[model samples]
Target: MFIFVGCAGGGTSSMFCQRIAKAINATDPNLTATFGGVNEVLADPIACIGDHDLMFAYGSIDVVRGYSAFDFGQLFDAILVAPQVKYLTVTKQKIMANYPTIVEDIPSEIFGKMNGEVAFEELRGELIMLDLLRGYQSSLQTASKNADKDIEILVLNADHRNQQLAKVFANWQRYGIRVLTETYTLEGLYQFDPPADFELRLLFGATMQLNQQDFVRISRRIDGLIVFSETPKTAFRDWRQQLDDADIPTAILDARMLEKRADVTQLSAKLTDFIQTVEFQAEATAGQIRLPKLQTKKAKKQHTLFGIISWNSTIK
Candidate 1:
């Protein structure tokens, strides 16, 4: 089989190709391997599809499948190849520094030809997993584009600074999902520029302490909610009670019993699944909505409506 090994840049792929080719060619002279930068190789469909039989794709295979020359009917397959497993310790450390979430437990050095084959085989699984994640991201993008209504989400946090959550928000935004991250402070609610519209809001963090008035205000803003139970504040309990009473579509994340906070991956996956499955219909007005205060009995009777729709009448 003809295989093309690629990396972010052509340099690493060259070394990998040399080693892989030497190992495979020793056994079967018919099998060949080549190297190139991933973008350059994937961009030129003629060279990639005409000369090579298979591509050792790193992430989502959508790009390869999109190739016009690719024949799906033929014996074609996308194989995932991870080069990190065979990397030197120093190189791995540098990679981990940038990608703190990417953790590889297995340690194997490819010293001999046999070791190279074994390491490559083990690394294949990692590539496949990466492909699956990329596929998930692609699905989100497609769904967002095709959705009749804009999909926007609010991420509530007590702490404003969380690198992991920021990355997750950024990823969702890249997939065409509008994200608004906010934190509750003594000063009041603080958030960056929010989306123009949102039908769904999700609440998290320990200090999102809400009073009865605060609860009523939020109920008007969101149609669906995913509430966490581990928070020490009674406001979370109150919020859940209100949502349950209103019969709103809500998902409860019970982390009360856990000894520690849930890691970023676990929480992000849960949020993603919830977003994908639920259909939100509540119409949140696209500006500041405030309930006008009523001082007199006549005013209370006249104010039958709530939010921006509320208006006053002339007694004439």
Candidate 2:
């Protein structure tokens, strides 16, 4: 079986596709998986839909909410017309649930005016109609394309951000990127050794309050820091000073900047430059580098709930 997974962005969704491919490949030697950004897939819907046995649509809740019934009809119809597709799976709710930071951060007023159940049913109805129309259109598009194939359409209503995060971490591990925390001790660090040819070394940390002493210790090993924009400018200033004192570089990223597709592309370019500069500086000061040996401890992992959706239909 050949599967094509399309996501809204390259960061989280790309990571999720990698994990799905890994898990599927491990269990089924006969199956293969590939992934791309959703816009890329939509640009040539005919080829994308016709070539894959299964097409997985991964999007945030905002994607669904932003689309009107008519717009969704066209999208749903396009996918349904693909003769080779046996399954059409949507994992939006799962995506929202996986990202607690996104959920909890949402204002209550946003939910106050809407009825959740009613909205969901309306969306589901639109999707079902699209499926029916696709079945009707299939015969006109391709005479030999699996007219008897069973097609399944499923929409899962559960959290998904955590699953995406798991994929992100897994990818980081595969690429040798170490994940560390703001904890003062060294043992609290989670490290990934990048490939020997990898040029940049980075450390990602998040905290409500950054300790200067801890920052000093972490800067010893990492060439730079990943700081979120949500952090106060005052805290960022202190962290910057500490990093500068230790001769380490810093990149301040806004988590919200990812909401817009265009911003995501721009951010990717900026990050690439930031990483290259830090790596160059680190290489120049290689002889003077001295890593600290702070105490180590096992990091505790958090657990969360996830949901799955599946559907089936006989091709006419």
Candidate 3:
């Protein structure tokens, strides 16, 4: 199977592969299948994956999902590190496809050491980074693993190599997870010509970059455009209203805001009347923030527990 790892194959993807290798025998009938990874899973170990038929690893170059044929290892002949000297050549190799930029002056191993460990502090002084350093990534990533962040419990588009009607069905089945799967073929091949970037500043948090094609793409994919940010942040009502105006599907994942705030209850109640029960996990914890805050369903449920012991005290 083609094991497609993602985003510069880092510690997350590598360790994840090792975790699943045990229970899933590669020799099984499942061929050309895929193994998905989040920020923590790595797609490395593919070269060694004997159970599967074909293997593919994606992500930044760290410990796992090392590199491929078009990778830097094979690109010594072209794409030098220096800029402005600009020696552009036309070869079969797609330059963007072979990244892992000839990492600066530091030796590969030393540089690897520094990038391997990333940490940041949040509300509770909690530091988050890749769980799997060099060890195999554990295979226990739940939809709630990174409950503290605006984590999207959505499945991504799986391996798209096999071009067939069946392939589309498989993609829908895998990525349509919990209703996150989407399909809208581009009218034509498209690319973001000039690179795009942005900065995100929070009142209580530092200014960070909401800069990725991924986020840009989200704008188009999500209809009604409510709930701009990922999770935990107070909903930008104006933004959410705009999305509601556009009529998009929505859900609330940030459990923290769900606790103290119930303004969205009106929207939830509407959802309750028309549709079947939603798919939600009881294990959900309070965390996350998103913008625009408008993904109205059939119901905006506003339920509260209010009780008083009105009876006279009885002898116990």
Task: Write one digit per residue (lDDT tens) for candidate 2, span 1-316.
Answer: 1122222333443444445444443543433334444554434444543433233333332332211211232233222111111121232222222111111111223212134333222323434444344344543432111122111111011112324333433555676654322232233331222233332333233453245544433443455665646443544665465556666666665555444333444555655576667657655665353333222111112221011111221111
Q: Which model scores highest in lDDT? A: 1
Would you give me the overall lDDT of model 3?
0.25
Q: List per-prediction Cα lDDT, in the order shown.
A: 0.38, 0.35, 0.25
Tell me the tens digit of each residue's lDDT in model 3 across 1-316: 2223322324543443333332233332332223333222122333233344223243343321211222222111112111111122222123233222122111223223222222100100110111111011212221111232221212122211213323333433464422222222221101212132211100111112112323322433222211223442654443445434433334433433223244445433432321222113212323222223322111111221011111111111
Q: Would you list the rank order by lDDT, best first?
A: 1, 2, 3
Candidate 1 wrongly placed segments (more than 4 Å):
1-160, 185-208, 229-239, 254-264, 277-279, 283-316
Q: Which prediction has more favorable TM-score, 2 or 3?
A: 2
The full ranking of all candidates by TM-score, starting with the best, is 1, 2, 3
Q: Pick the candidate with the highest TM-score.
A: 1
1-316 per-residue lDDT for model 1 (tens digits): 2233323344444555555545544543433334444444444434543443223323222222211111210111222223443343244333222111122323234312234466455544543454344334334332111123333333342333555556666777788666654443322221212345543333444524545634543433343555555543543554555566643445555444222354667756876777765443333322222222211101011222211111121111
